[model samples]
Target: MASFPPNRATTLKAAFRACDVGPLVGADIERYYVDLSNVRNTEAIESLNTRLDFLEPAEFCSILFTGHRGCGKSTELRKIQKRWEVEYKVIYIEADAEIDILDAEYTDLYLVIIKKVADELNKLNLKFDAQLLHNFETWFKEITQETEQTVERSVSISASAEAGGQIPFISKLLGKIQAQIKGADKQKQTIRQLLQKDIGRLQADINLLLGDAFVKLKQKYPEYEKGFLIIFDNLDRVPPNVANHLFFDYSEQLQSLHCTIVLTAPISVVYSEKNLSNAFDTPNIVPMVNIYKLERQRGDLEYNDVGIKAVASLIEQRVDIDAVFESPQDLLELVKASGGHVRQLMRITAKAFLTAATRKHNKVTTDDVTYAIKQEQFNFERSIPTELYSELAKVCLTKDVPKDENGWLMLFSLWVFEYNGKTRWNYINPTVRQSDAFQEALQSITANP
Candidate 1:
């Protein structure tokens, strides 16, 4: 709905080339970033930055960063890494990239964190003190009955004899154990149980390593004024059971680490029975970019012109909407249907582009948009049970999500979207309301009422 820059793509091929359904990373951040902090009403990463960088006594605490899966949480975290690289030796741990997320346990995370910190520092030629390394390695050996020889048998690290130091042996040992955890091998559970037997010792050892690493880094690297910052991304992909085990059951253990840690969580965690306030500070939530205007009456939400324009800018930054769509209104239609979800908008736009090409259209038409949205609506309809349709209609009417399991499931599934105003509220996904099941359900409820 808003005019875009002139240097955008002109051909359908160019439009297709511009589509990226994943989060922006690397150089793309500088190219395609749209600042929706004003619209989402939360400066998710900046708040953490303020706490760590600006606060008087240097607040070092475990942070909970959460949002819907594709609402640009990773992109924001990358922004933090890039923004504070000089001040913090940031170690970003991507759970999916590094671990078996579905079955991950707290012990597995402990292994992953220590291994990564060691590996990262080793790359900088900054090793933990040799005595500390020997102490930790000897403890691991006795606890798990795992010696350096047995560890090398599982993972193919070179002979430790050539690496003449305790740090290399310690690094190799951690690598082997973490590999066992990541590979889900026979030793995985054993390692977990052994670690859990003395989990406090494990925590103590890690904090010792962190403390030494902090001192070593601060001493060697004067530019690193804030020490180490470890961010755990995509931890949200873990199932609810595992999330509860990590965040609720073992929260204090997680917080006990003497470093600034940010853990991404599923958006549903906020509504869980266990209050996050009991464990960590208030979670820094990156809410959906509100496509609707502020101060609207309940159940009568209208699109905000500025919000719509911002959503369009997200697309325009990637593809030339003028080149892709037959009319500006066609782009607007997709934007409204996106419910301000970044990945959803890209999905719809890409699908419409492909559908247009198949239909022999030079540019994306309203017909293509309708087909894409209907396809998405069909997906949401199938995933939702018939019984929930009435409940979804009620959420649409009241702009509130129930704080029980059902509501958490709905938000997790994207059947409902959370938006920020004076307070947060829920509404049905824009395309979901287009389905016949939902329409019928809403009409039935209205008529009966």
Candidate 2:
């Protein structure tokens, strides 16, 4: 049998050869291929499809699509948007890109929406009022003191001069510009109030402009059934404070629009704040598609087998797996350790493949998979704060559940424990709960409270 020397290079080469026996793909594997044959959670997809179907008949339906990070939420959103575009005039925007909305300001929020709407118009080669563009220029100057005029700055020019006063490009450009500005400083605070007034005026102007356009379009194409649908994806990426304002404070205005609005947000955003629940109380307003419930079993061979097959299918589209792995089982081991996180699975696979390729191994084996996992764990540790683990340890040791709602929610959301064959919010690990420090902390908190 071939053996490795005690040296690091020799050991690495041996591991690489082992990995080649049945190479594992890492989390860094390309997502496009993995996501191509996306196994749609039938229930989640059906609910969303039902909403889209309803919206197609000139009805408004708002949905809050919630899932953990890397759980394919964005991919599903894109799929829905693409499918609805033929029937409904779809405009998709990312809320995280709107920086100014975090301060609980409705004006900045409106600006972002308007700007996104204008961008859609521009893409469709539509035109709108020159006067509105000029108004936007003046409003832009008043809000943002920048004097330089670029394609972005001349939104009014694009909206009015390029066509008739029918396109709302200026409004959309203003939203983009407003979203770029950060925090409610004294200067921005003053500008914000002024901008709010302009926003009201701008909204009125847009309602008239868009209303006229809708009428004209309907007159021209009597067969067109739906009005428009604007999807705001990645609202969860926004600061929670800002997200609350966008979803809660201005919900009515959003609903009242002649178009349908769909928002994708973290599940926590809806449940974390009482105000959020109160503001968005309409049961039909935001139908939720819980994607978190679809998590696959960790360390299950059958589960890993399916995931590996998915991963292999993805990798095969970009590179030759036969040249990478001796057999499929090599890849299966890596998938088993990945916990079904697509990104993590890809990353592990990629690293293992790279390691094997460097060592000129014909097939990856178990040893290489182990090495790749170690490498991934090392890289992951570097990105995460060292203190976070200590905090987690403290929580685990104390068995002291947090009193604050946010803190408790954070613990659950962060996946601090696994219980009853599913991830839940209880500290059931005996070893962790048995820690003296944990017990003491729990006593102290109980006594203090």
Candidate 3:
């Protein structure tokens, strides 16, 4: 029997650790590797292909893509962008890049929109028309001045010499000015009306800029026939209040815009009662692709088996697993325990390979997998707060928690565990269900007075 050289296994394990989760592993590994890409699912690819076909002409459609974080929503979006780039002018921006917009006053929202549009246009290597650029600058200046006046009228302060001396000139002047402006109710009302007027003008300028871009593209490429598409991801990452205003209050303005806007927002933002007024209803307006449906299908053997095969293949690329495992079953068990979460399985298997390699083991048995599982569990627990464990326990024992009014929302949050590049809320982790630690905690809770 061929044996791995002394420390050669350790070196191999370390090398595997450095490999990025992105990119294709070898062909054999590609078959078994849990693909976080949408290409992994036939259904998803077909659905997206159909959506792309519909959007090819680009008639101002608003789409909302929602999924559990890391369930490959972003990856799918990028794939669509890549596929559509040939036909449509595609521009992608992440909403979280503008974190300052969380506390954005109404005018600040318009500024963010303009900035994103300008950035995307620049990225596409498109030159802005000098006429439109001048109009945007004039509109932006007016909006900024109007916003400053509104802020001055909303906040009041009693300026003191001691505090004034320490404050920046801008802050001090704004503070004293705000105090004077806010003292009169009529002035405050006037400021609000002026701000609203400026916002309307800003919106008009943005519409004009988009119209100009579209017309210029059509004129430049008379033979080329596709509209521009701007995709915004991580809109949900914005503050809830701002997200509500952007989607709800400005829905009509967004819908009227010449370009197709695709937004990836959190499901909660669309569903929240406080934010629901005139917001696009969850089912009706936005085209949503459900990602969870791809994990399991009709009476098929749980895809967990396929997931295991995939991870094993990926591991083979970096580790000489033949010498470590007597049979593939041992490796499969490790994958099973990982609950199909690709990242977790890779991390656990990598750690176990390192552990076994250091021990000079030629065959990693079930014991090695067992050790790795425990190590992974410990790592997971350390990262999560103890409160989460308690909440999870509540979920596991009852299988159903109280809904509506008073309930532990976090329990519902954990219902879906992201595993093996899929989101699974229905499948329970068998190891977790059977573990003594988990059971003991449940028993202790049950027995308590």
Candidate 4:
């Protein structure tokens, strides 16, 4: 909850800052989190919590957590991490931060995981069996043709404190390999090819290290009864080809790692023609909060009060909405138009706040809100293909997203949003549907029918 400031300008500035679209982390999570599980009609947090809380540490389960880019998936993942970290050593890796996302391979992630595990265990003063480390080190060196001398020579010029002379051999080797993969250099493909040849050996070596680490952790901290939980975030940000490569071509590789892992994938993966469940369980989708009703009557879609309140709560938790907006109803108007996409709401709110401040309005007016949404709608419009308009019309009319590439495209582009009622469904984005072209397409389809 937020307290009112005496000056309207102070409130406006606070509103603008509160509307940042980035994921909330650390203390900010306490201040700004809104539980939308009931509104979205999916138990996203509980599903992961139940699995991790109940499963035996040796079970080695993997769950696919998915949603649109800004529907608060990362925030939810952080929540999951917070809940499970007490029992599991959570290694939260941002794929884009650690890998060349577009060009990443499964082996790239393998190296990243190994690097992180070895580094963490080193920090904890836990040592792997010397022979075990020596065997893997010798094999790794033979394949990549790197030894202590060469690694020391290469990284000496620009040495980081973490990968400095004092660290173990595995950490130094992994540091060099991770930099190569992320750097997109000639050696990237060479290393990947070497590891790809013996995928099982790579997985086996890593799992052994993980097992050793798990044993040490259990012995050291009784709280760590359960083993490691790797929260692999931002894998969803990879391009479709990379996603296909990581999740499809090497689905088994992603699953074979020995840990209770939570991985994020693009929404497209849920609708992909491939039966992903055979490889991993059905993806746990973080559907949009139910803004519009499941069915429209008399060609009018009704807003769900529960959904509106949840979306508004997301903003109110950060900003004193009544103080910033001209009226509570005006804030409602912004929420309805936001379509329950958290980032989109923030974007609209921030712009409207800036617009009102520029005009010196005491509060954000409906005109400012409208201007912000229209600007967002136009940006979305530019990305959409002309031919997709009719298809979007069909989705709007049917209240169902087609199970195909077009459906995936519409979702990926944010031209449509998924929801859950008695069953899963989709609807056009409110701003997109408000566009003249969409309205005309809707009319044309109705007239033809």
Candidate 5:
């Protein structure tokens, strides 16, 4: 029932424009955040809040948080940042945006974390030991001789633009290195390969800087008692191979950095062959917001009123539902089709708006909603291999996701929705369930069973 900002009376085109599909960030996030803790089973955010609140200021820990790509993991992480901002100097980094995410290594992550913490400390007018940073800069310079010309040019330009001391200078140099690491694959590989042999020295130098930075920051800002809390977000966007390498193979390196950290991992890692808990703590999973009635034995899916209203409120916060939708029923149908994925709901609603606008309808109608749903169905149908349809049906019939590649694939593709109840359950996506492939598979299972 709460109103969102940038709210106004508008034309159909403006209403369509208001329907943004990207993950909410910066100032816009404040307007659209909805609390789903009561409706969904996952307690990732709450558990994180409690743990971080109680953690010692200088103690280091790593926590893995993951979920489906568009299922609001970023939004939830941002919420955690806000809640802990008073106690921690949170350095929230979007890993993919900063690094070549698919090819990122543990060494690259260490450099990124060091650079970010230094950047944040500089903002607070805090400085680390000059000799420590000089040693690090010299070591990097020795290895980066091949790219000296380019690195010099970048640092020179940045230094001229922003005048500062040693910490700022190192920050600028690391900024250039970070840029090269992200921009050129060859450069990234060179940096990683060079650092591979000297990882101990690299980590040792960074830790020296971290120690100094932490001391200075704690001394300067008494309120920031917890020091730095680095959140490496969107590491979840990496492919499975890359995820396994980063979160599984090099998990110790990922955790060894001398600060509390939260990394977003791919959900598949939970079911990976690796014993993730052995390397890091048990991962915090953000499951889909359950929007269906519970059935102990799998059968036909039905809607849950509370879950339906929770998803519906996400849209109501952004646009005037009554003005855009022909009726509440039409809105409900669109929400049901989303299967509790936040971005999918917005994508479907955006499509419905486009369909209505294209048809010259004053507002969205049932036909518009159906057309939107069908378009999404086609999208899922194309991505999902025909061979997997039966597997999806098995999930729908048995209320269980197979612990095989096919099940993980369904989950990754969002063709199957995972939710927690008395235990975890998987169901065919509402729209995907309506596809001919799923219907036929369901019928085949029913007839045979």
Candidate 6:
């Protein structure tokens, strides 16, 4: 744990820094990670750990890990990587960072996996079978028109010294191709037209290289008995059409790769009518931490003490809450307004801190919280469609999220909260429900229902 300076100004600055509205990775994650395995059904991570821990090195398995953006899926995945580092050569890739994620195909994913695995293996002085490399190089050159001279110039101009050594000519060419596809729409169309016909040949050659690399890796690091674990993060951000093409249209190819893999998928796909389980098995979902106590029989909701503590612990890990807030009630109000979305809590807290400082308050107060929440409410009102108000009202009253596009939209937008008690249910975001339009809509529905 990191300690803060005792000065009041320094403490407030630390509080705001701790409330950053972005994903935490590496050391920052290890320092501040909260175990929510007991809070919701986080068995997804547990099951994945067991599978990798117990499965044979030669065996291949794929799991779909999903959750709304900022629900801490990446944090939990980092935890998984840390736990399995001793046994598996974990290669974590953010798909969006590597490819044109919006137009990505299974074939593109295949290239990334093979390149990354080969690159890692090269670090061990483990070389690929010469014939396999030759075939892939020849095929890629014939298709992409990449020559030795062009490859050298591209590599020299594009790569740093460390990355330069890891990337082979084939991998360097593919990297240039992916960058072109992402930046030039016209070039993407031309490149796809040229290589789509050789997709099968491309896949076969890459798989062979992977097999050779896997064998060499085991020969070098005998203790790394479990082979490779490739995690594809941020595939969840792709548009629905692209997701369908990669996860549905080419499901067989995605799973056929010979390694234990975890792919982050979009949350909406979990609710779609498509039978994803029949192909890749049921996806593991990271639901929101249950911050509210539900009296199901009476339909009453209140802040749960266990959940409040967990959310507060997130802040307390980095900042002393008592030192930053005028009273405990102000902190509680901010937590209640967050509705258990991790990023939302950070944003709201940061806003409240700014609100207090702008007004010269010694510490954050309830008035600062109220003003901050109102600002958030206005932002939501601007984005949410007027007609969806009625559907949101129904969810608040019935506590059931309709199994359709509207429901998925609400969940995606963070306008609703999903919980698993005896079964899955949803409720309106407390802040959204406080909007004047939402209040009127709820009254109308209550009168009619």
lDDT of 6 at 324: 80
**Model 6: worst 10 consecutive residues (lDDT sum):** 1-10
Better of 1 and 5 by TM-score: 5
**lDDT score of model 2?**
0.51
**Global lDDT of each model?**
0.81, 0.51, 0.50, 0.81, 0.81, 0.78
Can you write out model 2's per-residue Cα lDDT over 1-449, one digit (the tens) per residue? 12322221223333333322121122222222244234323345557778678654545656666544444556566667767767767777766566543454555545666566666656556555566556556656655664444435545555465656554436544643563456437756776666666666656765655554455445544444575677776665555455555667676665555556776655445445354546553222121111122223211112423434664554454444555567767766665545444445556766786676666666666677667777765554443343344444445444334444443343324323221122232232222233344445556644664
Q: Give the clash count for model 6.
A: 0
The sequence of per-residue lDDT tens digits that candidate 3 reaches over residues 1-449 is 12223232334354335323432222323233334333133343445456657754435666656533333455456666777777776777665554343432334333444455554454445556877777665554354363445544443354334444333222323333333333565654554466567666666777777776776666765433566767766664555456566666666655555577666654334344554434543311211112123323321124444445654554565555666566678777766665544445556676666666677765665777788788766654444445444445554544433332112232223222422223322333434544556666666666772
On lDDT, who's better, 2 or 5?
5
lDDT of 3: 0.50
Badly placed stretches (over 4 Å) of model 3 are: 1-45, 56-58, 95-125, 145-198, 221-224, 234-257, 267-278, 281-327, 347-391, 397-415, 418-449
Model 6 lDDT tens row, 150-239: 776767643657675556666677777777777788887877777778777877787788778778888899777788899999888876
Q: Write down the TM-score for model 1.
A: 0.91
What's the true lDDT of residue 215 in model 3?
Answer: 67
254-339 per-residue lDDT for model 4 (tens digits): 88888877889888777777867777887788888887766643234889898899898887787777678878887898899889
Model 6 stretches astray by more than 4 angstroms: 1-10, 156-158, 162-166, 295-300
Clashes of each: 0, 44, 8, 0, 0, 0
Query: What are the per-model C-alpha RMSD values against the true structure?
Result: 3.9, 9.7, 11.0, 3.1, 2.9, 2.9
Task: Write model 5 residue lDDT over 306-406, tens digit each, in one string.
Answer: 99999988888777877888898998998999999888998898888888999999999999999999999999989888888888888888887776666
TM-score between candidate 3 and the true structure: 0.60
Question: How high is each candidate's TM-score?
Answer: 0.91, 0.63, 0.60, 0.92, 0.92, 0.91
Model 6 lDDT vs. the true structure? Answer: 0.78
Lowest lDDT block of 10, candidate 4 = 1-10
